[model samples]
Target: MSATVGSALAWWARTQPEQTAIVVDGESLDYQGYEAWSSRVAVHLRDAGIVPGDRVGLLAENSLPWSAMALGIIKAGAVLVPLNSRFKPAELRKVADDAGLARVIASDAVVAVAREAAGMGAPYEVTAFADVVGLRDAEPDPATDAFRVDREPTDPIAVLFTSGSTGRSKGVVLTNQSLLSIVFEASLTEEGFRQGSTSLLVLPLAFTPGLVWGVLMTTVLGGTIVIEKDLVPGRAVRLMEEHRVQAVFGVPLIFDAFSRTPEFAEADLSSLRTAIVGGAAVPVPLLEAYAAKGVTLRQIYGMTEAGGVATATLRHEAKDHPATCGYGSIFTELKIVDADGQEVGPDEEGEILIKGPGVTPGYWGDPETTAEVITADGWLRSGDIGRKDADGRIAFADRLKDLIITGGINVSPIEIERVLMGLDGVAEVSVIPAKDEKFGETPAAIITPSSPDLTAADVVAHCEQQLSDYKVPRYVVLREDPLPRLPSGKIAKPQIKQDYADVHVDFDKVR
Candidate 1:
C-alpha cells in the first residue's frame, strides 16, 4: 500500500509510466514525466534544507508546475501549505506566521506580494517560481541521493486553510491516508471514476476540492486531469470538446456559466458523461439547464475537515432525487443528531456528524478547538444541520450557526431560498435574518432579477403560493449585481448578513 503522498504517485509511476497523468494548457505529461519532474522538485527542496515535519508553503497561479511542486514537497518528506492565490499581503502574512512556514514558492506576479508579507513579520524564505520548475536531468543534484520518502499514512502531509466564513480561518491537518484512501475506495465502487477516465477542472488547486479531491483522485487512477487555464465560458467549452473530457467537477456557478454561454447550446458535450456540482445549494433551474444537454448535475457535500469530499450523488441517482448529497461514500459514515447528541430518526433535522477513514485527525496545533468539534467517541462534528431519509439519502437544512430564531421558532433560510428560486424572474437569491421589532427576527432576501421587470411584490406573491406565513421573506432587496462570493467561490453569507442585519423593509411595501 502507498503509505505517503510520494509513494502514492510512485505506485502509478512504476505500473504505467507512459500513461497520460495530467493535461494542462494543451500540454500532456505521462506518468513517467510526472515521476521524473516531481523527483527533480524533491531534489530542489532537499537542497533548500527542507526536512520531514517542516511546513513548506506553495503560492502560485494554478498551473502544471504548481501541482508538481506540491508533490515534490511531499516526496521530500515536508508538509505542504497551499497559500490562497487571491490572498493579499496581510492575509498571506497571517497564515505564514501561523504555519511558521520554512519557505514559500511563488509566481512572478506574486513574488513581491509574498516578499512583502514576509517582510512585515515573517522570516521564512520566499523562493521564486522559476527556481522550483527550472529543474532538468541535464545536471543532476548530488543531494538527490539523500532524498527519501519516510512519512507514514497517519503523518500530516498537508495543512489546508479553510475559507474563513466563520470569522478567523483554521488550518485543517490532513494525512496521506485521509486523502489517497478516499479516491482509492471511490474508484472501486464508482463507475464514473476509473483508471482511464478523463476529467476537466478549473477551480484553484490551492483548495482541497480542487487539489486533494479533483487532482489527486484523477491522478491515482492514471486518468487525465485537463486543467482549464481560466474560467472563461467559451474557453472551458472549447477545451472540453477538444480533450474529450468524460467527467467534470466544480461549484454550481461554473456549470451555470457553461449553460448560459452562447457556444454551450451547440457545443459537442457528448463526451461529458458525469459531473459534480456543489460548494453551495444548487437551484433546480441550474440543474434543468444542464439536463436539457443530457447532463445530470450530481450534488456533493463536504468540508476541509473531512479531507475534501464526504458524499457525492451518483450520476444515475441525481435525476430523481436532486436534493440528496447521496449516501456517505464507502470510506465515510454520516449521522444526524439532535442538540442532545442522540441520533435522530429519518427526516428528523439535526447536526451532521461524520466518522470514517477520510476524516482528519484534527486541526493543526489547536487541541482545544479540535476537541470541541471531534467528540470523545471519534465522530467529527460537521456543524451543518441536515437530515437523512429512511433510505439514507441526506438533505441539508442550514448551518447550525446560520439558523434563525424568531419568536422561539427555528427557521431554515435554505428552505425558503429553495422555494423562492422556483419562482420565475428570480435569477439568484440569498435569505438572511432581518431584525424585526415585533418578531425579533424575520427572513430577508437579496435577489438578482432574471428579467428587468421583476419586483418585490412578484417575489412575495410567489412565496405566498408555496410557503407558510412566517417562512415568507418580509424584506426583499432587488439588485442588478451578483452576490458577494468567498475565495472558494461559495456565496459570502457573512457579508450578506452584515449588509442587511439592521436594514428593515416596510410591511406596506412588501404587501
Candidate 2:
C-alpha cells in the first residue's frame, strides 16, 4: 500500500487513540484529539477557499497549532510554505510572493510581522491562529468530514527556502513520499523507533531538520513529542526531567550552551538515550562532555534539499568515532566523487553526493539553479566535501566553497575549527579565506573567546603546534560576543567575512 502523510496520521490515531501524541507547553493532545483538531483546521482552510493545489503559508513558531496546521495543510492536499519566523517583514514578503500563497496563518508573536508583510501588497490574506480557531469553535465546521485523501505520495508537501552562495534564497520543493522515505528508513534502521518513545523538540520547524527529523519522524514512529517555546538550556533540562524525554535533537550551538549549564551536572538526564547533534562541525571536546554525562551524541549531516538527514553517526559507533558523520541511512546511497565527478576510493576526500528516495525532486520555480545541484542521472551534488573510511564510515571535511586556498594549497576550515574548538580559551571559531596580493587567498581566523584573557598570539601559537604553517590563520579577529548565526543554527560565515574584510594583514605582522 502507498503511504501518504494523512494516512500515516490516521494509522497512529487508530492504534493509539488515547496515547499522548503531542505536548505543547503544558497542553496535551492525544492522537484522537490531534486528529479531530486537524480535521477542523482542514475544514476551516477549505472554507477559506483553499484548494488542493493552493499554497498556504505558515508563519509561526514551534507549537502544537503549528504542527496541526502542517498536518491539516497536507491532509487538505495543499502545499505548506513554512515562513521563517526570524525573517524581517521585507524578507517575509519576498518569500510569500515567491510561493504564491493564498493565505497566511500566523502565531500571535509573529502576527505583526506577517501583517506588515501582507501590507507590502502581496496578493495574500493574513489570519492569526487565535482568530481562525476562535471562529471555528463558535461555528464548528459541520463540513469537517469533507476531507478526502486525494494527494499522491509524489505530491509536493512543503517548500523550504535556503540562502544561496550568491546571497539569493532558493525555494526547495519536498514531496510527501520524499519525506516519508526518510521516516520509513529511519524506522527500519538501528535508530528505529520503539512504541511510546518520547522526543524533545527545540529546533525551529521552518528548518528542514526540525520539520522533517525532529517532528515528522517522531510522529510517524508512534513517539510522543514534547514541544518547547525556545531552546533555553536550563528550561530544556527541566522539560527533559519533567517529561522523561528519551531523545533530544540539537545543533552544536545548543550543545555548547547545554554543556555550560548547571543542569549538565545536576539534571537527571538518564531518560535520554540519544542526542542527535548537527548543523555544524561537532567538536570532539563537546562530544566527550556529553559522553561523560552518559549521553550519546550522534553527528548528523543533512540539508534542506535532502529531507533533513542524509547521514548520522550510529549509536554503536558514536563513542569510538566522534568526528565521523557516520554511514548512509537506509533510504539513501552516498558517494564521494572527485572533481571529474568520478567515484573515489575509500578514505579519499571528495564532494559528497547523494541519490535516494529522500532526495527532493527539484527546487521550486528555479530550473536553472535546480539543474546546477541535481544531475539528470538523479545524483544530488551536496557541495559538501567528505571521505569514507574502509569501514564505510563517512567523515566530513568542509564545504567545497569554504575551502581556503593559500599559496595554491587547499585547507579545510572545518579541520582548523575543530582543533581551535578544543583550545582552552576559544569558545567558537570560523575560518575564511582573505584575499591576498601575492597568493590568491589566505586563511583568516575569527575567534570568540571563552576567557577574556585569550589573545591572537595564543591562538596562533596553539595552531602552529598542531596545524601546518600555511594552514594556520594569517590574521585573528577577536569577537567580544558570540558569532552571528544563520537560521539553521550554523555560524554565519558570510556575515563574518563581510564584518572583518577590512582588517586583513600579513601573517608576520600578527606573529
Q: Candidate 2 clashing pairs?
A: none
lDDT of 2 by residue, 250-329 (tens): 78888878888887778888888778888777777788888888888899887778877788899888878988888888
Q: Which lDDT tens digits does candidate 1 get at residues 154-255? A: 899889889876656888998887777777766765536777788887888898867776677776677788886578988888878888888887888889
lDDT of 2: 0.80
Question: What are the RMSDs of all candidates, in order?
Answer: 2.5, 2.4
List residue ranges in candidate 1 displaced over 4 A.
136-148, 505-511
Runs of candidate 2 exceeding 4 Å displacement: 135-149, 163-168, 505-509
Candidate 2, residue 321: Cα displacement in angstroms equals: 1.7
Residue 261 CA error for candidate 1 (Å)?
Answer: 2.7
